[model samples]
Target: MTDDRTQDAPVEDQHPQPIDDKVAGILVQEEADLAGHDQAEILEALRQRFADAGIAISEDELLEQSVRIAGADGGDFSDR
Candidate 1:
């Protein structure tokens, strides 16, 4: 029998990325409930959250990823 999966839309598209791989980015994104919090405050909270989630990312690494994500999204961290 022929495969039914479409080439353009992989199975992963139907699901969220593995949480561990994206936990930091997802947390820093504007979509999270982080309204009105400045960058420093957000990062502190994120550091705690990461530890709580058992993801051992260094503060520098977390800052780097957050900056990267913010830059990629035009630094627009306003609530959606």
Candidate 2:
């Protein structure tokens, strides 16, 4: 029997890193900064950041991740 998994699989196929203390702190800061911003603005900002970081992400995917992060931070998005 031989292993079938390829060693050169795309990074996207790997599971994302688990959120730790450092990530938690970053999330808190991001949540604070995003407070009072509308969803469209937030999504735009995040998309720009991702592009600057050389990451390719669709607007919808970025928005989904942003909402997930906000929810994890116990944020109230109703205001914006």
Candidate 3:
């Protein structure tokens, strides 16, 4: 037996909705770009977009991840 109220609950108040096909496609493209590009280039583009959107991210964290990604690509972000 199922309760109708449970089914009517908003997603944020319960489980998140599954990502639709269009969103999945976008995610795939973004991931491919991340993998195929330089880490600093990718990170810089992300920072610029967020800055233009009036959102800010911590430079320390971004540098940390950038270094990790760069190391994986035979490059280094430490000197940056």
TM-score: which candidate is best?
A: 1
* Model 3 stretches with alpha carbons more than 4 Å out: 1-32, 67-80
lDDT of 1 by residue, 1-80 (tens): 98896768646556657766566465655324454446666667677777765667777876755554444444455432
Q: Least accurate stretch of 10 residues (summed lDDT) in model 3? A: 71-80
lDDT of 1: 0.58
Summarize candidate 2's per-residue lDDT along 1-80 as a digit string, tens digits: 99898868658346555435333444355556775556666666676665654556566766775775445434552322
Task: State in Å the error of residue 73, model 2.
Answer: 7.4
lDDT by residue for model 3 over 1-80, one digit each (tens)?
97666556645437554435333333234344454467777668556644653445578755654455444433222222
Question: Lowest-scoring 10 consecutive residues by lDDT in candidate 2?
Answer: 71-80
Clash list (residue pairs), candidate 2 = none
Global CA lDDT of candidate 3, please?
Answer: 0.49
Q: What is the lDDT of residue 32 in candidate 3?
A: 44
Candidates by lDDT, descending order = 1, 2, 3
Model 2: what TM-score?
A: 0.42
lDDT of 2: 0.56
Question: How close is every model to the real structure, measured as TM-score?
Answer: 0.44, 0.42, 0.38
lDDT of 1 at 2: 88
